[model samples]
Target: MESRKLQIRDLTLRDGQQSLFATRLKQEEIDKLLPYYENAGFYIMEVWGGAVPDSVMRYLDESPWNRLRTISKAMKGKSLLSALSRGRNLFGYVPYPDSVLEGFYKEAIANGLNVMRIFDALNDIDNVKESIRLINQLGGIADGAVCYTVDPKEEHTDTTVKKGFFGRLFGKKDEIVEPKKIFTDEYFVEKAKQMEDLGAKIITLKDMAGLVNPSRAASIISKLKSTLKVPVDFHTHCTPGYGLASSLMAIIHGVDILDTNIWWFGGGSAAPALELIYVFANKLGIEVEVNMEAVGRIRKELRTVREELHAFDLVKNFPKEFDPLTDTLPAEIDALFDKAIEAAKADNEAELLDACHAIEDYFGFPKPNLLVKEAEVPGGMYSNMVAQLKALQAEDLLDDAMRLIPKVRRDAGLVPLVTPTSQIVGSQAVSVALDRKKGNPDYSNPSNQFISLVKGEYGHTPVAVDPEFRAKITGSPEEKAYDVSKYKKPENPVLPEYGGVKLAANDEEYLLLELLPSVANGFLKRRRAEEWEAANAAKKAEEAAANAAAEAEKADDEPITGEVVTAQILPGTVIEVNVKPGDKVNKGDVLLVYEAMKMENNVEAGHDATVKRVFVKPGDIFAPEAVLVEFE
Candidate 1:
């Protein structure tokens, strides 16, 4: 049997709005778009709800429920309706009241919505679980959303600076400040498990801010899929140029669902467009199963609708010769950016902001939200431009800034921002700059400046010390950095006797010998101790063996006592000779030597009697029956 196919969720209405004006998408416009999406074979359409602030929710002329109803009626017999709901919105961020969430979920589900997405900006598990409960109670499938944002603490080490910026701007800095523990692999896994336990049918990774790279997306999604039982999906923005790459990576990692826009509507300056993704996926043999012709038609119709509303003009003021495909960018765009970089070299706020807006306009319209407020602060645009240039590794451009710094600084009456530390910028930033300068951009490699920065802060490698030297060095609060080459094993030394020292069988003594240093010791203290212990052990073993040999020799030399003289002597018996044959002899004296079993037997007097007869000579072989002499 064939495996089940992955699901595709169309986020043209929700996430796509980031690229265009959401307010411009009226009910009638949505009505025209819904049928096309259905015909295009899209399974899930993420409509709206995540952007609803309390103040604006009431003012929403067409509510989320109303939009769902319209799309359901229009796309009958094709596609499920889905809406994104946030834990909170601008007016006051709060997890939607259970009762309110239950009502909204029931209304949408009753109106033909099949899935309700519960998203939190920070991927808060509790809030996601709460929404899941409400959705389940209302008889709708609940999806737990994990949004990707700049984890303030993870990306930037200083919470104080991050909090200050957000606190002054939004008055709710604490809401965004992550906990000190920071997110880890185990943490994400546990959160996924929690969502599954909370009855969420699907777990979606929402790349809200588009910070994920292709490699990161693949690793994260693959890990999540392998670790969790529920279905996994990926939602990403086109920021930083990873749009299509991230999607492909997600597919490679076994993601069960993916979110994409109809065209380039959801992409940023560097992001890959949906059209390109389809083209690439086709070439790579991934069966997306999307209708390209239908998508193209929708794109054209959407563009027509946007043009009629004059939405492009409202948000952006383009030059007379501006052409989105070719000539839209100002000739001065690069120059103005260079000038601001030079001015930033001198730390000139006014000059930098001026150049920033010019560059910003050249790129798009009302300026990116990230740059808008930052432009007002000193060194803001300059710092940002430096970061970008550093990221790009445009060395010639960097060289230009470096050369222009003194001149710009002298004119602006300010000290240059460049310092000794800047010289050590990482290779990643330099590499990016080099690539950009060459006009062949590769996002896979990071700028050199970034590498240097991280290395400078964290120190470079794992360190280990010789066990003997461990006592000499003091414990450090920081991580010990060691050269990798120092870790190779040394050759064992040859010892005298036993060919080589045979490792013996005692625990404490063996451990002490093993601890002996392999290299030259400054004081040879441990070496001396080990040598002494080995010698002592050997000496003791040798003495014990020698003593046992001496005892055996003594036992062999001892004399045998009297035994009965019989005609038949038994083997292993000590026989005694009593008498000898002579003219006259005294009694009770040794007479002859009797031998048996290849050993000479000691002969002695058997009784107090005179020797009557002599029996055998010393050279004669004897059996157990042989007798030497007899006494009476």
Candidate 2:
């Protein structure tokens, strides 16, 4: 059989870690695997972008720029290094000035990034137009990504309207309703063509939620192949269980490249496993050019890393013998059997709960359930919803929120559910659900982001937003796109010293501080502290000893009696405070609202009490476990 070589872009380091563990894969862990990745001969290795920059600094206390440079240097000429960019957003949620984007792209390419897959959540080419041009000018391949989403209605098909005998006699004829697809093959094909015309070397069908089925994947891939002059790549997730099938269909339909991962890191919310795809591709006379030996070594190393990062592992209860490839369990025991045995033998329920919780703190927040294949919500979006509801102690509102998502999305001009849009819609849906539960009318308390979305601050929506709905969300029905040209960069953009050390020494550090101000500042302070401790070990030890002695001397004093509620999980900015001094609160009442991980979290009261004081107010940033409110 004549061999058909199929190109594969590995997502193990970027999107795989992102989907599985909130992009908390440490630099050291990546360093361990970088050598193998360079020798593996993948068509493209996704080393940076997505949630990496923010997560690295926000959680891991590492520089995102350093990671990009390190990976680029390792993979210099061995293989292509690609990063995911959110178009004009450029890894941040809101749009940045062209000058900022230009600087970021220039720095990114200079740091050794070879390709940048640029995408817009709204599928509005206007959002990505400038980024694509900027990347190409910087000598990086711009893989233009068109977000894929299905219409809320049923699959498009011809509908027959039969006329009755009296109606036929009255000259009314039987009518056939043609299949009208909002997100049709033609629709995607046209979007791909537009990107191609804008000088995009490659077109990508980016199904972030794993929502595209095999049929649609084939149709889109075929249409893209026929219509676009450039190569077509498919990037989907395993959330809806459509990834493997859709990817196989894409390969069969002549897709230029496919996004896949290695076994353990892939699947669940990530992409399809490369090992499985290789077997299937081989059967179809397609050759996947990757070193199986390096993959095996990487898998072994990943198993160790997976155990170390078990708190973020989605499948915390997997049996060793359980095979993910065939979805088979060993004859001797299964996951259920292991769970039953552990439950029966466990002596302490508290210990078990503690163990479970430790694993839930992957990115300093609870990991979402990975079994969202049958769920109405995608994994990432569903996780955010659950986290937000859990924060408010409104777990019962999950059902209502999920039900409201479609309506909310429809009203938002049927925008593709990705990134900022998905989070915006999901968060607003929860808000609407909470409002309805509070006996208020729906959309009564829309979030600031939701209002911005309806006002076209992000970009144009796929369909024209309903004028009435737009007015209801935002006071005006007028639609206006945010003019990036008018954005003025601050005169003093350099980050101030944190702990007497300059936070940003160069353009890369400056970009970090610019894109994620709060996280970067916090990380820089922590870095300074760590460096101080390392450099002055004896001085730090003496200071720690003195502090310990002082703390012990003060321990004998009478303890404060008020119950203090501290921030849990991760650091966040206080957005609103509901409780004031002398205010009474119940166990479930929200004391304050804070924004964390892009979701607004409501800090609720644990018991009935009078509010003694609020330590944090709106715009105040707090760390995890810092006292937020004091109750009497």
On residues 115-232, what C-alpha lDDT tens digit does candidate 1 reach at each position?
Answer: 8877643354654666788787777888887654322212232333434565758764444444443334455566677788889898887665455656667667878998889889
Query: Would you give me the overall lDDT of model 2?
Result: 0.78
Best by lDDT: 2
Candidate 1: stretches off by over 4 Å: 1-6, 52-60, 88-92, 150-181, 269-272, 312-632
Sliding window of 10 residues with minimal summed lDDT for model 2: 357-366
Candidate 2 on 143-240: residue-level lDDT in tens? 99999887753222233333456544563343433334588888888888999999999899999888876667777888899888888999998665
Q: Candidate 2 — which residues are off by over 4 angstroms? A: 154-180, 317-376, 485-501, 528-632
lDDT of each: 0.50, 0.78
